[model samples]
Target: MEEQRVRPGGPPAWWGHGPPWRDGADGEERRARWPWRSTVLLTAFVLAGSQIAARGQLDERAALDPFARVLLLIAAGQLLWRHRCPRAVAFGTAATVAVYLGAGYPYGPVLLTVAVACFNAIVAGHRRAAWAALGMLWAAHVLVAHRLYRWLPPSGDTAASWGQEAVTAAWVVAIVALAELARARREQWARERAERAQGARRRADEERLRIARELHDVLAHSLSVINVQAGVGLALLDTDPEQARTALTTIKGASKEALGEVRQVLDSLRTPGDAPRAPAPGLDRLPELVEAAADAGLAVRVEGTAPRLPPATDLAAFRIVQEALTNAVRHSGSRHARVRLTREAGALRLRIDDDGPAAGADAGGGGNGLAGMRERAAALGGTIEAGARPDGGFSVIAVLPLAPPHREEEDR
Candidate 1:
């Protein structure tokens, strides 16, 4: 079986999540029924309006005979399929209107059917077809009204005035121009909707990445400390009861702190618009990282100080340092690491190094740690470099902008 993808804040595609234009014809067709209400109303209007028009022009045109009424019905009925087959309905209505006029029937709402069909066709993106259909109808009316009137029409009729033809031409231009306007407006609205959807998807992706990074940094650093302490506790459990108790105490503190941070991260998801309960961890929390590293048996020496910073930049800097130290604890052979912070004019530089021979092949946790660190830095228009130090050690350096770019904040 194949799995289907679902969008956040929207149903699956198969659930018909959007408009027919955005989704497809199948979904719209499924929801469609006979256009009975509209079609019936239009037909009645054309029939009744034609009767009054024919009575008024009783001497100039044919009476509203049964045949003339049928022609009007056919023209109006063509609108029933305007949405399903716009081009066909457009041409069909125009053709019917032309025939009704060729037989000298009184002009009434019959032309309205053709206008409505042409409008739907143009709005449905069949511009050329609708234009041609209306043009053909106009040309047919011209031929019958001018040259074929004597042979085709009831009794005796004269050629239509050039002024009337000009009026008809202008009407045709107006209809086409109006449809073009509607089509352009619809297109602009669709573009805006699509951009809004795209932005929503982008923001969703960024948020998911942020949560994952936060969880990784918090759990990885905490778990590394807990793992080391757990081992120490078990090793000295019987031989040195006091030392074992102290190790257990460290583990308890690390686990409790980890739970608090994890809960904070989860709280943001529960109430997205609410302010965080605790201030986000920043360089101000450096002592916590140092204390945690010491518990993990990795001696960490910190150098330099960072000025107060924006929440986003501060958080990124804090996470990068935490992840770097976590990696040092888990991968480096030596027990010592050094961290240096250099504040430049508009940036903060972090450099972390540990003497190493590399604990194992999977020492860097297969690159997720490094990738997460790099992502944190890059999100702030910064860069990160980590590799083996030619002199038997590993080093990670990151340069982060003090102020994040405007677009980056919008993305968040």
Candidate 2:
């Protein structure tokens, strides 16, 4: 997998939790607080507006009294708890407005309280409750305006016009429509937030796997050479001082090279999105692998030349050969290994073999070298096979595609 290119900044403020309004887990924004200041201001507006409206409807409706003021206050007060108890507040405000109108009080800002309540309920996912409340209030207003007005409060009240009823019905429909629109927008925002979070997690997992493969390939190959050289140096320390010094020198060179490669890998983490300072290792470095194996007492022969290839394919091919030879030095009894590279029309085939009689019981089931080799091949849309050869030898075979399976989309 390719390394991720992070943007030049820290993670987003809402990276883990999503936006502030969308912080709630189960639809409602539990962490977002409802404002009591708006509700308090609304109450003052409704009280003052009713008195002004009462003067215009003095001949048609009952005058606004202390009792009428109390009813308006009750309706507005219900909005304070609309977010916490949407269903209850929705029905409560609707019922209060119905009773005030039935008492022949002048029509005014009392209906605004019901609108606010229903808005909160619908946005909170209480659609049925909000719709039912508005329906009940409309039905009560119809009965009071058409039939009950004959026996109700104003001394000489007449039946209200159907025109007035049409206006009220239009207001109810508008509130419900507006609330439905808000609910849909809220749900859309939430879905987008969830998709972003899921994408982030998947990218993080892929990066972790890429880093693991890089570390295993570098450390395993270098450490295996060091181990073999250390064993040789110990055996020749007293018998052949000259050979012992050469073994020690090989160990130093191998360790230094390993440190440089490991540091390159670490640099990618610290400065993400920047091109690597040193070019990645590729098939051109096959000579280095051959010399390193010789230092560890293994003779590796190259059979075919590698052609110019894409960076990813070349890197994967090199790692596969390096890992296969490392496995031979650590597990195979034979000191000779042969690597044959075959460049086909669309793919590159690599085969590494060592004539062997198993070195130990855990020959094939050893460390992560083989697994890392297979992972590298698979990442390039390739395949790897490593096991005991039918002719009493161990072989690692890989087939890698020359081009990536698909063109990567450029970052937006």
Candidate 3:
């Protein structure tokens, strides 16, 4: 019934959405409104400037017309709501700029509002819409310019009929294209950030699965043997006092061993800041593990001397044997088992055979025990194959690399 607890500061399984405030109402309340506040202030400044320009145009000495002044005011007001509806604001501002220019309002600072609106529309992911708005503004500029100036070209232009409208359209198109490029760059950055977050979550999930598999292998075999011995001790308590006492002693020893194994498994979850403890069982503990299995009423035979292995390889070997013996005692109902460990050229081979009940003759008796053993071996750069023998027995075979293929040997 043990559960895995997520450690604080560990990488999250998934990236969170939006800003911190969007994640929770409480966070929203605590967040500062500085960005929005600054936006409002800047907007007020722009509006004030626009009003000043309008007043200057309206002065008696100024050559500006009244109609052009009115168009400038309308464009400035619509820009105040730009963030709410960027596309609409861009269209309104562009139209006003066209009208003001046609009415001879000097067409100077008034065009700045139209430029700002175009930038806002493209940045808000409305590139096509911004282009369409630009076209409409160009058409308006042509119509008004032609009507107000009596189809005569402006002072600098040659007296070509269609050249003025073409020049105006080109300018609007160039401005909109620049804004679209800026928007595209921003979108690329956002996409990169999203991809990095997704990769982090995927790696975290993989780590979680690996940890779960290791824990299952470590706990399953040890607990099964302990449970069987305890059951035997309880059963013998009434009929045979001496046998019962012996069984009880075995139970105590098995319980202590199980506790040590459990502690070893849990210790892996500790951080570097935590206190250190004794090292976990490795290849050195193989003989002791075999003895423990014998005490649990399974006769185990050990073969060939094993080479010195890395801690990870050694631990994987110990667990594989432990799981094999546990299976024999639990499912096979057999009293005898044989375990062989051999150091070959570049690999360590482990073979365990048990003459348990024929019915359950399979790797760790074909349940969680075998699956856990296979998982352990695989984690240590090893492979395991378990099945029933033709002679009414179960066998498990594992091949583990002594050292990683690409890495040089280090102090073990």
- Tell me the tens digit of each residue's lDDT in model 2 across 341-379: 998868999999988866877454375777888888888
Error of 2 at 172 (Å): 2.5
In terms of lDDT, the poorest run of 10 residues in model 1 is 1-10
Which candidate leads the pack in lDDT? 2
What's the distance in Å from true for residue 34, model 2? 5.4
Model 3, residue 350: distance off in Å is 2.4
If ranked by lDDT, best first, what sequence of candidates would result? 2, 1, 3
Candidate 2 off by > 4 Å: 1-34, 364-367, 407-412
Mark the regions of model 3 whose C-alpha exceeds 4 Å error after superposition: 1-83, 138-148, 151-182, 238-243, 260-280, 359-363, 379-381, 403-412
- How high a TM-score does candidate 2 get? 0.87
State the local distance difference test value for candidate 1: 0.84
Candidate 2 structure lDDT: 0.85
- Extract clashing residue pairs from model 2: none
Which run of 10 residues does model 2 get worst, by summed lDDT?
A: 1-10
Evaluate all candidate structures by whole-model CA lDDT and list the values in order.
Answer: 0.84, 0.85, 0.66
TM-scores for the candidates: 0.90, 0.87, 0.71
